[model samples]
Target: MNIDSIKNYPTGSSVKHKRKITNALEYRQESAELCDKKSVNRGYSGSFTGIGINRAAANDFKNLGNTFTDKIFRSKKFQNIVEIFENKTVVASTLVALIVAGVARPLTNIAMAGDKDKEDSMYAAAHAISSAVIGFVISSIVMAPFDKAFRKIKDDPKKYLQGLEELLDVKEIGKRKLEKSKPYKKISKVAQMIPDTLVLGVPKAMLTIALIPPILKYVFHLEKGKKKGAAPQAAQSQNLDVNNNAVKNNPAFSMIKGGVK
Candidate 1:
């Protein structure tokens, strides 16, 4: 072979090898760029998917809460309770008073005492009983007529609401319309509460305080007494027993006892 031909052959072979290496490097760089773009697209898609899921969960929770509330509001027991509170205002007020005065107050007093004793407990109980009795009795007697009138108004709004048309802001009122009126409902509820909360509250408390001492002395036998002659005491005890027996045997007393039971 010729020397010039051999040298040219080696140079051409080297140039061909360099071009192949450059092509390979370019292909690798293009593949890496495509991978990066795909990764970014996947990341964006994943974030969107997460956001959609969260929004769906939130909407589901809101719907569930609304459905639960609607069920509670439409329940029969809830309606009955509301009916009783509206119709038996005096009785409802008395029950609240009894719970606060007869049950909660005595328990609170005993719990708050630093050094508890029988005398302290007895005194608290006596006050509680007296307050409960006085509040029940007075509220029943005082609010009966008002409750009856309100019932009459509820039953016959067309007849009863004629006098208070201006105050109620409706020219024509019927039972159905009055029941549906939000403003009238609110006003009537407040009016029903006024006798117990405003008119009778302070007076009942004062009367209860006044009667506590007498209740403790006579009912609970809390006071100390001087000894009496045995013969007179025996006679008094006999008469008291006879009176109690007679009262117990009375037809009216028997009927009352049965009714209470």
Candidate 2:
């Protein structure tokens, strides 16, 4: 009989109703299993998964940053500055790469060369190598103060801000609870971008600039990858495989491990 006809007997005695109940039970079990998976907690109020402040977002920021640097380097006014960086950071291996790939790569091949050949492995290899040098040079020169500033903030953001306050002729740090001021917000974003500029921005930009044929190589190419600055650090669980195995194998380990911690 249909479920509608089951009113003649108690609900559990109805086969259709029992089947529906079994389905619900299975659905609930599946939902419970999903809850056991990882979810990023949303700032104490809620939680979400695979949404907002993710890796792709950070990579976008870095790529944008590298594009900016590319413009700066390509500017006619910045030739001297770029040269300074090229001179300062280019070590022996980089010097060789710069000379060989930058100079020889262009003059050696005519018919063999052309950026339209996207599948050419030799071109990509030469580009990645040569671009790495220029990338290191530009990032190193420009990011010196940036590196120091980020390091200062990373170690102690409060102290760094307080130092700025003292320099600005505000009351000493301990005299009052130092707070964010208008100028702080203005400088915060540019200041925070330094790390990503070094790590993701430079490397991606290197691959970018390197890929161009000898003429426009310095003016183009940027593939920004990450922004460590904006991204909050994720707490990592330590791998203790031996300890886990011991606890599983010996129930007595539960007491010993628990008590020690």
Candidate 3:
């Protein structure tokens, strides 16, 4: 008989069907046995594996949450402005030096030395050393107020972050009720800028008045210039453009333009 005719035969009388069923049953039993052996070797049952994974993940999450809440949010309050300023200044200074040195490297390669081999090498070495010293000094001066500002923010993370959030109009903190609280109320605009004023003024006035030839020339490379004010001109030009556009689009600018002219 053909394969199709064999399928039409009754199962109880069919030897081929009986043999296939027996082989399928044996394969299923072998698969189950192998699975059990592998599970035992790995020391895992389905129930225990899931529970162990969930418990470990939960513990790790808990530790991370606790560290953020305890160490960052609550423990450090803004108290010592001077200490905060100094520490921040040091970090800022270090960062400034690193940035300046990176920028000065290419400049050194170009402008550092003459092409006579030995003389060029000596000049290059001297230039690098001098550049390093300049970088450190510039960094120290630049970082003072920056560090103070950092400390101010670090000391009161929420308040500082809130103010920035407000200034930027960030949506996450925009509607938070905590922004109207006592800590946020205590800081003023003038107080916020105090560190900057002091940092700049003290060094500047000292450099301008105390030094004979002006240390600012060599140290910071100070420049002098005056910018002409342009507020009125900018406002008038913007108004004129708006008027012209409104006349072009809405037919209302004609009357307004005529009156203004």
Candidate 4:
């Protein structure tokens, strides 16, 4: 019974009943605490298990990345490409220029399309072609002498690199030895590129710009009979139309126009 029922019983019986009730409550509290401890232990175990699983997955991914990288490094085709780029520096540089000017620049211009003053895609193509041609021609001509000189040095490092043997810390440097030296190879590549980078770059760009108009006229037949004065007025009128349309469609302009009305 409850505490109220114990009050109607004898004093000694009531005290005994109260003791029994207290013992039951203490046992239930202890059982609840034990259950809580068991749940906490289970939570810790599950957390550790989750951590172990994540660590295993991470390790698997790491091993897979390493394996893929190792395969690429060991591949014969990859090695051959690397060897070609290292040995055929002129070819490498020319290919880079072609990609930048002919491929990348033209693609960028086409993607940008009508964002600029020159709306004609053919003009962009012509410019890209001119740039690529000028870069290839000028680089080949200018780097040829430097390449020949470096080749001579590579052929006989003993004669050319005589005084710098001690600085390089190698005795009797051979062609193979010099080729294998990373620092020397880097220096040789940079030295070969110097004339093209410093001397020919700006002059070649200027020459390309000077040649683009004639190329567009003769080769592409664009703007064939247009007068210079008319062309400027037409271009300016087109730009004004574009700007007016942009303003008319703008959200802020719409808000201002609505407010004014």
Candidate 5:
């Protein structure tokens, strides 16, 4: 703190607070020094520690690993082994494995947080590897049957599309049966629509609008047929005159009040 700020404080309280701050600063410095000493002496065979076997073993193991890795990578047998995992199925499985490993982090955050007291380095590493293996196995199992079909579809898309049309229950559009022996009669709205919408991705608004015309035509034609059949019968039921005479010459009508007056 600035001298002026310290001077602003009451003399007694300021000296007390100043001593407390000084002690805190000294404590922090001592802690930092201890940490530095430990880190610096970590690799050293200091008076308090014992043998240097671990350091020598680590160096030798590193050199041996490097030698083997270089040899394996350069060998033709290794290249062939690498090529074995280069196929579509294994590549797809590898991709799945990587994705599953990445997803495992957030997924384990809650569950592992409660179960384990603290993280262990080796356990974390093994869990990541296991996650990838689990994903690879699952993806392989799921993609097995589809692999040959996928290859076939990729080879000949037209055949695959024909098969898809059959699966989706689509029929050839506008192929009218001109030579049909029987007359054509309209079918229900559901039967009329299924083929068209099966191709159109099932848009409800468009399907409803498309159905209006066929339904309207059917209704109008049905009403016209009923009218045509009823017209002659209606005419035949009209009242008939018993005698060929005018209204004034009819005897029953002349007997009434204003019929013949």
Candidate 6:
């Protein structure tokens, strides 16, 4: 279809169309990688704990993860995260594993080592207690910021939803023009429901827990698509090939083609 046709195509229809060629696996992988980049670039809380000096600074560093998570997911950014994770479960899973391994395990061990009755080793015990207290305090402080970010994601559900809409809308338009056979329509309808399922199903709720980084990543790709121009071109040489094949088999045109030479 020509660019104008695609542009004029109903948004609803375009979405349904694009859904066909759009590979879920690729989208998921791309989104997952993008999400990781954002998380790292934005500064996970652990990255801020430099040198461990200045208890207050360390405390801020400790909570940096929450802050970063809260900020990205609370805004349109959350959609990007969701899109990425939709395809890449490993990214999310690995992150959770790392958090528990790196943060929780050490804290629990230290806290247990600081038993109050260890008088003979009171200094070591006291050090453990002090360490545990600082860790807890820092954690609590960081959690506040993280919670704020999470609230932001909840506050704006449309960012990623809009992205999905744009994608789905374009696909619908493409399908109507390119694949209008009755059988194709049935398949298209089923395909259209996948995103709806994703948005409405268990993943929707889990987004809050996992921080919706994958969705946010997909949104980023959408933005990039817009920047690169998502609008399809009709005048491009490829269209001629498409049109030629389409009309070549017509009964009236069949003789006309073979008679040309």
> Quick one: RMSD of model 3?
23.8
Model 4 stretches with alpha carbons more than 4 Å out: 1-84, 87-91, 111-118, 223-261
Q: Whole-model lDDT, candidate 2?
A: 0.43
In the range 77-116, model 2's lDDT, one tens digit per residue, is 7887555443333233344445665555434543454554
Error of 4 at 82 (Å): 5.4
* Tens-digit lDDT track of model 1 for 9-113: 433466664443336555456445544565543422223322234445546546553687778877898788677677878667676767776687667656765
- TM-score quality measure for candidate 6: 0.19
Measured with C-alpha atoms, the lDDT of residue 84 in candidate 6 is 37
Give the runs in model 6 whose Cα sits over 4 Å from its true position.
1-120, 164-261
For TM-score, candidate 1 versus 3, the one ahead is 1
Ranking by lDDT: 1, 4, 2, 3, 5, 6
* Model 4, residue pairs in steric clash: none
RMSD in angstroms between candidate 6 and the native structure over all alpha carbons: 34.3
In model 4, the Cα lDDT at residue 19 comes to: 55
Q: Global lDDT of each model?
A: 0.59, 0.43, 0.41, 0.57, 0.39, 0.38
Give a tens-digit lDDT track for model 4, residues 78-174.
8986875665565567667677756776676567666443444445455556556656676677666777787788778888887675666556587
Which residue pairs does candidate 3 place in steric collision? none
Clashes of each: 0, 1, 0, 0, 0, 45
Candidates' TM-scores? 0.49, 0.23, 0.27, 0.49, 0.23, 0.19
Top candidate, metric lDDT = 1
Give per-residue CA lDDT, model 6, range 181-254, as digits (tens).
45434534443334323433343323322332222235222221233221121111111324543454355676
- Flag the better candidate by lDDT, 4 or 5: 4
